[model samples]
Target chain A: MADQKDGNDRKTTVLEDLKGLKEVVKVKTQEQVEELKKPQETQLYRSIFRIKHDEEPRNRALSTLNNLFFHIHPAKVNRDATRYGYTWGLGGITFYLFIVLVFTGVMLMFYYHPTKVQAFRDILYLENDVPFGRLLRNMHRWAAHLMVMAVWLHMFRVFMSGSYKRPREFNWCVGVLLMVLTLLLSFTGYLLPDDQLGFWAVTVGTNMARATPLLGHQGPFGPQLGMTPYNDVRFALLGGSIVDANALLRAYIWHCIAIPLIASVFMGVHFWRVRKDGGISGPSPVMLESEAKN
Target chain B: MFGDWHQLWVIISTPDNIPIVAMLGLVPFFTWFAFHNMLANDRLIAQLEADPQLARTHHRTTYPYNSRWERELHTNPFLMRKELLAAIIITIILMVWALTLNAPLEEPANASVTMNPAKAPWYFLGLQEMLEYFDPWIAGVLVPTLIIIGLMAIPYIDANPLGNGYYTYHQRRHAVWTFLIGFEAIWLVLVCIGTFIRGPGFMWYWPTQTWDPDRVEFNVNRNLDQILGINGSWISHILPTAWRPEAAIIARALWGIIPMVVYGVLAALFIHWICKRSAYSRKIYSKMSIIQTVTMYIFLITMLFVPVTIFLRLVFRIKYIWETPWFSI
Candidate 1:
């Protein structure tokens, strides 16, 4: 204790000596800063970017809120949320795959068009003609597939963790919406290549949609509802009775724009609600061991 | 014949307007209800402040602290680091995979020349496989819808509240095992079969056998009519002449329906027995609502039914208990 006090006294004495040196040098330490700033402006916080370094606690407290990208995070969070073993960050990877898809998709669009006539040729050109077009297409295709897997696994994680309780119910619904949207996005993108596998896969898929009980024509109660080829749900989707140029254009528009827009709206709500609902569901140490035993 | 005025009125009025009508009517009610609750809460708080004894009596007890973490340790520096590491690892893996494999691009589509045994994508392969056994209405439409809705509704319908915020398979064994067996074992296994085991004309292929284009296999379905002797029955003779032919066909179909009816009857009796027992079974069974009880039995029966039906189909070559032009469910 005595040695620590002696060290502190020495530190204070050195600081006092620096004060004298500061006066002698008077090297624009305070006066220059004041002169540089407008009289109406304050001395601190005078920089364009928040360049001022505050105390550690205050700085850390405001770090999330002060930044644009980090605002999704709560100002306060539980230690349980930081534990890497609890959740495998599947949800984050799903979002990352979405980002990867968009980036590669936009680049691929530069070399392609959504028409039956040009779609196949565009793919060939991408593979044999354009530089790294194959890589771009591959990345997009693999990432879209990965996103579906990630979203499903994310839902599994959330369900197993039992995180969708009470106040979190609404967010859970949003998450399910996002999952369906993810699948829809992948489904719509499946036909853009216009290959046999893509074509038949979509044909089988939309054919299933045509059996949607009451809503679809070829489905149960469809004939009773007076559904015909021209008026059925599948026709509305394909924009014709068959998968033609119109179908290609419809898939492209949905994959590129509509689904992404809806997914973004749900994602924004999901993140904000997660923050508002105290940042990820986790067990707190406050529970009694007896209660835990049950 | 029934294009009457009232029927036309009901068709024109009720088909599309119900949803819009409901929404328009409920908006103001919900708005008012929100405000009413807020003001009521405020008034209650003021009243509590004015009288301590009544407030104490009304509150009755302290709120339970169920959380298991401390607040001071919830910062994100460690989490952010971990997230960054995961992203970097994933990016490397994705880059490696993209370089290693090319996306599948089969020959340009020809609608006239449909690919042999054309299949849906991997995710829907399980549903497609089921279409071999059941009607399109059930396998393709109803099953997928039920599975999706059931998954979403589980957290709401589950009776146990002990498994939240932790991984406790021991505590939630019933829930976990049901999901794993029903979805992973049955559905995903079917998907694997659909992907690898099936070949041209949807014929089962051994792994040793190469799927040759020239392979010829016939899938002749043997229904109850064929199995039970489509010879005219005694009931056909007793029935009126107009119904005689149809009655014989119905008697043949009844052979397939016998097992299903017996199974349902036995299950119902077993549940009734449980409700009368003097143990945990009785407690849980009696407490279950009608919907809950029915759902439990339905879930168990369906899980058992799939394997049994598949067994009968493969072993006995029984096709359908009931058949129609549109379905054979």
Candidate 2:
């Protein structure tokens, strides 16, 4: 009978030990779940962009490819290209300025009309009434001029580097085309304000346009081509003998809508080809050769 | 006043301009950063060779250890840094600039009252300055066309392959000289003259001279015709006939050829010098062949001609060095 009683006590102790072990396992699992939930707040953000902290380069490339914003750039760029010295960021700066122009230009349109009378008044209204209106006009004009200089400097840098060889030759032509477009856009915009500076400046500019050789009657050989005051490139451009209400309207549409669209297309081609052309010519053979000797 | 320079910055920093100022600030910062990076890299390269172990780890050597990644091969430290830096820096600059300076606004548009000097916008100041020297057609039409064409043709014509990536004076002397000279002589100098030197009458006024509406200078300019007393109507001056437009015109046209002959010879001799100095080699001459050589030389000389003609006008008041009914040479 004493032996039976000891057996009962040992069995009960074994059962109690099992209960304790189960409780410990349950508590540890609950603690792990809570710890995991702590990271979820940050994970919400990381998951939105599909970015991971420890992603290898493969994911970086995948991220770049999948994202619309990153498409303009390669998945990876050469460290050399990152150095501020090489291109002087002129090309990139020009692009940024263009973006600035687009943003501010749209703002100006809200208060502006292409008409001769309304154009100046609208500018005045923008300056006085609309919030931050004067700022937009100033930034737009400044950036327009700056973009012209920046593009030229970019071309100069490219020329100096001789990056315009072989594959880039066609792109160079496209660049020149873009420069012409930029000048035209600026020229047209110059007259839109219709101030003493704008009016007279456009007078000088359109008069030059009037002298386009094959296109205008005022130009040399224009008479032979049957270009006349009534029917010439200038007439088509201005819709009149000189810069009038019609001229303002024409410049307005071109400045606001037309040229920017054309520029956008060419710019797309320009940026796309930059990638195709091996992403900005790395230090070429001659550079390496010179370095080796040094 | 010198203080007027500061007035340009009295931008009336309203909320609207904050964006513009921010952008403007970024530009200078970006420029500074670039120069800083260049100097640092030079410093790095200077030390890398001294320590072979450092050089071994750096991509300064032909190979790098992280061969598994193509990015390691193509790229250096990183690129995303630059992209982000450029954006952030520009944003900051535009923000600051807009917060400080006011964009300029003048009176309403008046078609009736033209500004006295009636300047074109600054970009076209170069062309406007040229208009003073030549006929409207030549300065406005022909020159701009030629400039665009000439710029387009540079890559195709330039055969020197030695200076592809690196900017070196020794290897690419011809290209460097051509680009710098063209930029300085034609574009930059003319723009300066138009912007700073031109005054109310579209006349030459030094920067020290203020633009005064009351100032009236005389038209003391004497053309070649008047100086020589070669009145195209008065044949009695040099022609055998009495006062007749035809005889006087003939005599004047004949005299005009003299300068042409002088310039022609000068151009030829210069072309010869160019070919010889380039060692008569096709490789380093920027272009090959006699025709290409002659054309390039003439283009350079002609670019120089405008400035020289302007100089003669300012100093000697000489006009129509060579003249015809259609144009002047």
Candidate 3:
């Protein structure tokens, strides 16, 4: 009887303590409800929380973007692969150059005019008139040069690594197309300045176009220059008798707009395919043989 | 076939116009397909988690990374210091360089005037030089096409299993280095020689005849007659042929032979040398298969000299000492 009574008293004391604690919590929650009722108080608290946790939310958004974006391969890149000359391989550098081109090209578009009459003047204005215009142009020019070089290096890197082997043959062909497009982009851009250098360069370049087999007259075993069918491929390229203003306009459009848009499309596909094909393979033995011979 | 009204929604909603609209229409169909696969994976994970015994067995091996490299910047002390510093420095340098130099701007473009010394952009100069040697058909179209096709075909053709890097180069060093070094050396020489040598004229180099003003005038008259269509001679009448006042046949012949001979000898010597270097002999050659990569700077310097020599020869035709001893390729 004594033990039972002691247990009951102990239980009663514990319950009373719990009740007191519950009352305090109830009051606190009531106070929170009152604050929420006041819109300003709610907003202040929300703002304070946001200020404190802004970066966390931003990081989450960034991660989400990474998850969603299709171009990037989802794999964690190798952090310690510096056996080659650079930390990131040649492909990474080329990608970096592409980024630069995109950024600078956007800035340049503000001032650039695609028309034949204004194209030359706009280029001149960028060089001589605009503040930091010269630098922008220079950067654009140098970046273009570097982009080509990096791309070539990337191709060589892929070639030497034997990355193009087996299942990647189609992708390799796409890459080759990308390389040609890069050169074509550079060539068309060269004509944009419309200077003596640009004009003559186009002339000489187009002259070579005239020599194309089945297309041009300078074929090894085909129609001569003044034959029955005057299949002058060069004439067609110029859109008339010779390389005139029309050719310049065409080159400009292809350079500034068409080629870039096409390259971007292919680039997206290229990057996605790389992910699908399994992230880049390590160097193979064939590369080693090539190295040894060198 | 009945038209679907939903296609109109796709066409309107797509920001990139009609083609993008068609592609965007795939999203819902793909979403449904992907959702099924995702549910399957979820179910698998849930099943593994629900059974305590299975969870216990799988937990140890299933989790890919217990510890991973922190992706956030400034997380790793060493990496933060090195990468951040390097990126800053390089970006600044590039930006500054871009800012200072005004890009080249030439005179207003006119298609009418044929500018003398019409040079291709520096990067295209290699191909331009090649055009002079081979038929333009070969140089411009056939060669470029071949190069592209060859590159694409590489992956399929070279299917050796030594991809792990340990075994490939250990076998075939001779063929690889021979191809690489020989190719580079030859291209470098050809490009260099093409740049330096100007038009073979009497006043510039070995004179076939003493500087005769009267002979030049006579040739000029003949050239004008050919241009004006006054000349009835078959050679002049048939096609436009600019009269060479006094150019040496031997000099012209030498010009053609020297580049070929030089390239041939270099290629042969490189093959022979690499054959003897037994220590590094490997079957799969690397991109830089030989040490001749160090020689590229020399080649670049020589290429610069070629253009300079050509310019000097053109300006000072009478000055023999200034004239390059090398003939035009």
Candidate 4:
């Protein structure tokens, strides 16, 4: 009789445990379902508002932007468009244009100047004077600004996508170089006005140049490095041992012509390689989580 | 006017001065040589055509062999439309702008009088900024040399074919961020320090400390003048000290060995961290990291903002800030 009683209790306990396990499993599954459903929220907003409400006009605008000529990249590249945490995505094209600007810029420099006395006049001459002057200068300026915008967007896009991963490492390096070139191009071109702004900038800029190793002869390693002999490179660059009229002309030549040529060559290689390699990186998992629901 | 074979030594030694002598020396020699070569060619062609084996062989004429890709490329406008379009757009814009706005030309080149600020071309601003922060040896010479050499050696270093952009970052998580952050850091720091941190001498009109301007002036004149005497008063007199705060400390601590020490430490730390976290061998990490770091550094330098802002501000003279870290004067 006692053994039967104990057996009855044991059976009841087993039944209760089974019921508890079932409940737990149901809850866990429900939680996963909720997790899976979370991503659809943004899609709902996107479809309900941004896409649905203005679908026609927006789509048309996008189409225009994506056309072969005016547009820099696909209107909608990768969703990884704004991650500061990493770098990748739309940055490639920005670098490409920068290179293009540099190239055409150098060619344009066969006739350009950044001097108050001659800059504006030179522009007049280049346009009305040089055979293809007008077209070349405009293209260089436009491309430079466009490259700046592209590079900024590209950086933001990379940051958003979090594509700055292990394997795509060196391309990041290329991106950095492109960014520097963009700014340099802008800075040098700024002086072409030969206005007050141009004058001040060149003055500041040359001051900085003079700080160069062995050339500046002021830094820790300048004296130690034996950069004295190659001082002529600096002198020639400055157009004198000091920054004078020769310096201004030299800067003008370099800003307008010399460096642009070099930049163009490198830019070409960079872009060709970028296309040869591939387009932008796809979105990361974290980024996809928000999108996956839709 | 000309030397014969016997006097060839005199002609060779003073080659530049022997303008008439050169013509005299070459005229007869070339005249004789041309006849000999023309005659020799005739003999050789005759010998070849006369050969029994050549005569027996069927004479085959061949047209130029070109690939379909090449032939199609010649006619196909769409083949390189993107590049061509880019080029055209660039050309059109530059030409118009140049025509509308002519850049100034300063007075004909003179080296005596120095300008207030002297700068290199736009592309070189980053390097120019580097000269401001670190020793020019490191910034102007060594660092640039290393970057170029390193760039050339990229293919040999990172041989991994795993992620060429197809896979998501999750697949190659370690490599991506490492490249981005590391590159961004080096570039940002170098560019920022190069541009932003001009010596305090150039930053404000007066020293902040209670020290006498006269004493400071005397000291600067005594020590600084000697170092910078060669460039003279026109440019160097107005410029800031080449050294920055970090530079002085780094210079003193390492005795010219600081940069290398810093680079070594960072490299070792990076490799160790990567290895410990991923269980990947050091060899793999080193390869990926080298490409990753160099690439990042380049990218980071490209994004440098201080110099760009300074350049733009200087150009426009928009006095956005009345007082800046440097250039109060």
Best by TM-score: 2
Fraction of true A-B contacts recovered by candidate 4: 0.11
TM-score of candidate 4 chain B vs. the reference: 0.41
Residue lDDT tens for model 2, B1-329:
23343323332142323333343454346435434533444455556646667666665422222646555321211565676688777667666665566565557777777787788766788899888887677788888887887777776666566556544454555676777677655686687677666767787766555566667777666657557776565445565545454765665676778776787678668655654574423335644656656666667667767777888887997766766554564
How many angstroms is residue B231 displaced in model 1 relative to the true structure, after the best TM-score fit? 7.0
Point to the candidate with the largest lDDT.
2
Per model, state how many residue pairs clash.
8, 20, 28, 61
lDDT of 2 by residue, A1-294 (tens): 223324554544667667567666777788768877757346665677665534466666766765677767787776455656677787888889889999999888888988876888888888888998877877787678668777777777777666787678778888888888888888889888877777788788777766777777877678888988889877888889877899899999999899999999999999999889877865442332224321
Ranked candidates, highest DockQ first: 2, 1, 3, 4
Model 2, TM vs. native? 0.78
lDDT of each: 0.67, 0.69, 0.51, 0.45
Model 1: per-residue Cα lDDT over B189-289, one tens digit each? 67666765666677676544555567776656677656656644766877788978688555655554665678777766764664455443344455567
lDDT tens per residue, model 4, A1-294: 223324554544667667567666777788768867764345655553343333354654444353444243333332222222223223444645655665776686666555546755776677688876766665666566556545644643443233333434455566556565666667666656454445555555554444454545443445566545237345555666654456567666666666667666666655555444443453221111111211
Clashing pairs in 1: A77-B74, A78-B74, A283-B68, A284-B67, A284-B68, A284-B69, A285-B68, A285-B69
- Interface RMSDs of the predictions, in order, are 10.5, 5.2, 12.6, 20.9
RMSD of each: 16.5, 8.7, 19.9, 31.8
Q: Write candidate 1's Cα lDDT for A159-255 as tens digits.
A: 6666775557778878988887987898788888888877887787777667767667878788789877667888888888777788899999999
Off by over 4 Å in 1: A1-55, A165-167, A214-217, A283-294, B1-71, B224-241, B248-259, B263-288
* lDDT for predicted candidate 2 compared with the true structure: 0.69
Residue-by-residue lDDT tens digits, candidate 3, B1-329: 12444434432332212212232343233334333433443454456546656655442211122345542231123333343454455457567656654455667767676554465654455566656444576567775665565445445444343332211222323323322332243433333333332112211111122222233212221211223332233333333345432123323333435444554466555644554466433222233324333333233233333333334334532112111122222
